[model samples]
Target: MSLSIYSIDLAKHSFSIHGEDTNGNTLIHKTISRAKVLTFFANLPPAIVGMEACGSSHYWARELTKLGHTAKIMASKYVAPFRTGAKNDLNDAVAICVAVTRPSTRFVKIKSAEQQSILMLHRARDNWVHERTALLNQIRAVMAEFGIIAPKGRHALQANIGHVLEDAENQLPDLARAILADCYDHLLSINQRIADQERCFDMLVNHSNNAQKIMKVAGVGPITATVVIASIGKGEQFDKGRDFAAWLELVPTQYSTGGKPRLGRITKKGDKYLRTLLVHGARAAITNIGNKTDRLSLWCKGLVERRGLKRAIVALAAKNARIIWSLLRNDTEYQVAV
Candidate 1:
């Protein structure tokens, strides 16, 4: 039988496949070992293949595409409602198959190996940054125990750490002093690593033309710009700037009945890391908006005055997401509104 579509529940050692023919008759249903997956698909006629967008799904999608079959990677949440029976790999595969057939189901864009590689740097840098923050907090706690206090900022801590450790009047025990010194050294090491990673990111941004274009937008820097470029590539998957902004979950959530709409907070539905970076960039831009006399800055200042700072930041972030979408979609440079 010629199958219309096949949905695969991907796993490490095996995969569950569910298939139906053009007349809506069940034709293939079973689990196959990982080594034989390609062989099984190869024997069948070219058809649409569906899988939940999870680990290894993108890689498998790429491989399936190479075999002359259409590959669709869907968000698991969208497929869950289609499950008919008890939760299991087979049932999940069936659900995926059902979901993929729906005309309105959204599929994840398959990321290339290059995109994944660039993202690795971001993940590494984020991990080290968290470690640095933890170490700083630990240092502050330990210093407070000795009746020595570090000030608010990282630079203040840097200035006071050596003095606290060397002060004889603080009566620091030998063991405690040695531990704190070791922790301080570790903190220094982490800082150096973060700096190195940032340097690498800087070089990457300088080479990427799209990243440079994104950076031109207000509030976006090397980190945010590279992330946008790496995550969306050409942004062709998004139909418009609003679609892209909604994907980032920057748009407001809505609840409506009787044609009366009530909007709430942002959906926050997408990548947490990227969303956070965008918000932080927006905050920075908002803080500086008052100092500038440009049209965009003046408009942002008006928004801040009307909506207050927090909402203003979110609005600007959502606006920037739209601007980013436009730049990527059109491959055009940003020109600040005068």
Candidate 2:
């Protein structure tokens, strides 16, 4: 029996699909509307379909699955090698078709609607945080021109906002005051939007079994759990827990020759957003806010004492990612050396 493979190059409004049969022949080639992709897939013979994991790839994966096609999403990096010369939709599609049939290629696991939906909140929250930071920076830059200096940190700046606004003795011109006030208002609105998104995240994670299980580990909270789960997707895609942490770029980059290994900074390979969450979560765990003690806290505190706070946070986040993998993969609850 021979298997056929198809590759699709997607765009904003149109896409090109190229197919190659087991006999090394171009079986099909065509361009179609983005809106009509699923309909087209339903009419084609059931075969393996490959598309770059960009934009709305997951949604298409789910739809194709429903239509009985074995669709797989390959990351663009993996598909890039096959594309030679100039890049165009047709050539890209042909390259994808070529790449998918390779013996040792990796494919992204298709995420469910619930996974994507939950992830949307994290994305939305992150955007709002970025907007807030930009707004604060604009306020700071604008105020500095008038000799107004506020302390570092969001809390410090926020605490001084009222004082700055009320202090008439300060040399801030009326125009400066008006601009700062508008920026401050924008910052406040962005913060509120972020808080709202977090609430949605809380609701979604509270409803997930995996999220609850992972959260039992110290340093894993609602946000951390959401980040870890969404970033890793299905844990089975990784060979082991360490692989997941390394994918998160928490592991050190290695330079080794002839069995002598030298590790540098973390490779920083995967989702930076999730990596940041875990690091921050690790910081809180070491803070030990609840005066609660657990194996995770013990590990985090030990690292902090040995490696200092920042490095310790990174180490603990790396450790937490592995523990999360264990919990999710083995289907076990968190325990203190049980």
Candidate 3:
């Protein structure tokens, strides 16, 4: 019998595949080496292929689509409930096969090569930033051990680190001074790399009309705009603005019971990096909202007074996320309320 659906549990070298016919009867279940995967799929008639979203899943999805098969990549959590046996590649593949056919399963957006490249840039920059922060903390701790204290803040550390290194009166040893000097230089290098990434983001924003359109929102800057574009092109996967906000996990978490509704804190799920950028941008907007009488600014002021500063910031971030969805999905600019 001809196979109607195929699910693959992907790995670095071996892949487990499970296939079913149109009548839901199992057709094939086996493992194939990485080299033979494409050749195997190339011979099959176009059918629905499913895989859990993970490393290299998008690349495989693109390849499968090129083979005239409809590929569906789903979050692993959605597929886990379908597994009938112990967790293994074959079982995972079977789970994927079952989950893909479910109507309510939410699938992840397939990122393009360009979008993936931009996200890689962001990841690299984020790594460097974390590394830099760690280095700074190390330097501070080492200096404190020698009874030398640099003032707080990055700028303060930058300003005093040199003097601390040069000062022979402090208890700092020659070895510790040399090590700190090297760390400071590394910090500078990481800073330069981060600046380069920002420049790349700036160029991306200039070239992408979608990024430009979303930047008109109050809480959207170049970083947030470019990230949103790279993460979701035109926001078409979501049916509405609230759906987009919910996907971002900016909405409150629900813990409702029978005939009762209860909402908790923000879910704090999904892409943490993207959520962080949105929240930081929201904080920046709120910090500078003084004396502004626009509708959004007025709303922010009232919200801050009513719900406190932190909740207001999250509310603004959620609102901005929705506005961004509307702007991108409709291919229109944000209209500022005067």
Winning model by TM-score: 3
RMSD score of candidate 2 (Å):
2.7
| TM-score for each candidate, following the candidate numbering | 0.95, 0.88, 0.97
For candidate 1, the per-residue lDDT at 267 reads 70
Model 2 — TM-score against the truth? 0.88
**lDDT tens digits by residue: candidate 1, 275-326:** 8999999999988765788888998899888989999898888899999999
Residue 230 miss distance in model 3 (angstroms): 0.7
lDDT of candidate 3 over 113-152, digit per residue (tens): 9999999988998898899889899989988888887799
Q: Which stretches of candidate 3 lie over 4 Å from their true place?
A: 1-3
| Candidate 2 residue lDDT tens string, 1-338 | 66688888978889898888888799878888888887777887788989999978888888888988888888888888989878889889999998888777888888888778767878888888887888788777777877888889988998788799989999788887887788788788888888888787788687888998888876778887886677565498888989889888899998999999999998667888888888888887777634445655666667677889889878878888888898888888888752
Clashes of each: 0, 0, 0
**Cα-based lDDT at residue 164, candidate 1:** 77
Best-to-worst order by TM-score is 3, 1, 2
Which one wins on lDDT? 3
Judged by whole-model lDDT over C-alpha atoms, candidate 1 comes out at 0.89
Error in Å for residue 49 of model 3: 0.3
